[model samples]
Target: MSDDHASSSDTTAATPAPRSLDDALALMRDLRARCEWDRVQTHASLRPYLIEEAHEVDDAIAQGDDAVLRDELGDLFLQVLFHSVVAEERGAFGMQDVAGALIAKMHARHPHLYGDGVKRSWESMKAAKAKRSTLEDGLPAGLPSLHRAHRLQDRAAGVGFDWPDALGPLAKVREEVEEVASLIDPATGAVTNQDALEAELGDLLFAVVNLCRKTGVHGALALDRTNAKFVRRYATMERLAQADGKTLSTLTLDEQDHYWDAVKAEERAG
Candidate 1:
């Protein structure tokens, strides 16, 4: 056969593989129709589980487990199909509609790749589509404070409503610290105005998060690493104390400090 004919013959003889998306959608549809548990579920009912699966995926990524990440991602994808299938039963939209909207959105966002439109910033496109008047309007209210602060700063910065340089945020951090200090009694070292102390402390943390954003560091990830480090050091101290026939609670402050210092020394030696 000629090369073109041979290619065509090969293409015709090849068997088509089943698509995972289609299989998943079929599974969702079947569950929604027959399974009592799935049939009773609604978008509102599955909200918490969707959030949980997303966090599980994040945890899996942090643990550096590809198998767990893949499994968690599959669970997360199932949430999408589940919600779409639920909507389908209510005469709304289905997975195809969800996918089509996403595809359209991505194409619209990347006009340089798909159309004769000029490339524009993602924030600009998002702002144009957003109904809210403020930059921080669309952010979820339940987001962790640090993440919310980071995103809020980012949104504001996108519109040039930000400090000029790293120094600005660093200076802001100092100012916030001073404000927090003012909320405490100078002699007693006790927080006199609890409410004001809370607010000022929040401002200090927000400033630090902004500094993290400007310095190309993720505040949450930095905090997570610090937390892990603390846990490791504390556990080492506990093990050392146990070896010396003592408990951490039984040690004096100075003695505990000695073990803590020892742990730091060991870590540095390693």
Candidate 2:
């Protein structure tokens, strides 16, 4: 039966009741079977759509528009239904099974609520769940190098596998900076040792991210905020330029730098 027909039937029943999750799954299954386009969908073919929908959701979230976010979230959710319906047609578990498994897993993981009644701090909870300490266990291999380095150091430090205090990391970062400076050739006015300098610079950055992590700051979030601040300030400068019947593209680097400084000074003064 069509979803509309099923809804009408349920609503018109003598007894009153809320629609169950299974009812929604049943309607999705019926729609998949009867709709010509839906019947032709395969897992491999739907992968692109799933990815696109997820990115749309991300875009809406980034824009900070709740209304667009709600609609985008619904579209992303349909991807879940589409996948489950396809799986069910192939004799795999349906949406109910998916929901049940996720619910069970969540309950199992949250021991303070559903398992042993022990109060747990976030750090203690993480330490309990972490079961390994090798390089492989430190961080996922696929994260961007900076982010991976941050996570790697944070995980290590959590288990007493780190410097005794903040001073140690601070000293190491200073040492890295000195090494990177030495790798530059002053007489030649060029980098004499690119590899060594690059490695030292990377170490310095990693140490900074680690320090941020240890101090209860997120390196990624801080960098993102800085990026947004720069974008906003630059856009403000662009508007000022447009008001003068000029564009940023027509401005020299020095001219732009002056405008940027003025903008930053104005913010500080305000």
Candidate 3:
């Protein structure tokens, strides 16, 4: 072979294709070594980025953008490694420690994988795992209240503490809504009792979340999708108004409603 070709072959042979986890770790280590922003980041500094990256990954998944999803997922994993690195520096835990803990936990939870016998189904295995976890173990307090409640309900349900069907939760939701309306005292146009109003509102929200839990719907994600759709539709309305030489705020309520209806029709038609 020619000298240049032999040199290229030697280089290719020396560099092995990395396993997925190993490639991820190597990139993380390289960032910590050479990236200025990454080098200075501590767990506290990376907290917001961790949440942001996670949301970005979710967005990519929803949009079905494989390249963007892969990149966002890597960013999310980097945050995990960053936190582990900081913890390691503080003598708390390292990457190996994190991996070991997760592996041990998974093995312990999956008795089908490492215990009595093979699991017949994933549902039964999940139930077994939930029974093994404490009340606080399955649901983090820091999660959004709706999400936390759903998770808490699921865990509780695994232990036989749940509504029998959607009908029961639906009835409870209606009762809570009625109590909230009663708190308003519509004739006065004022909340004569603030405590009653607040209590009723809380109860109503809790009941709605319970209904969602029973119906296998995620209240938080449902709200998030609606919020995103509203923003997009409103932006389209604003652009249409601006193109027609008008400010959205200056338009009459009826005129704005007309534009909103048009936008809704367009979206539906599309």
Q: List, residue by residue over 90-142, the lDDT tens digit for candidate 2.
A: 99888878989999867765778988977544433566676665644645455
- Which of the numbered candidates is closest to the native, going by highest TM-score? 1
lDDT of 3 at 76: 74
Query: Which 10-residue span in candidate 1 carries the lowest summed lDDT?
Result: 1-10
> What's the number of clashes in each of the models?
0, 0, 0
For model 3, the run of ten residues with the poorest summed lDDT: 2-11
Ordered from best to worst lDDT, the candidate numbers read 1, 3, 2
lDDT of 3 by residue, 127-201 (tens): 775665566575545798878777767766766777889998899999998888887778886877899899888
lDDT of 1 by residue, 82-126 (tens): 889888888898788998999999998899999776887666667
- Models 1 onward score TM values of 0.85, 0.70, 0.72
lDDT of each: 0.82, 0.72, 0.75
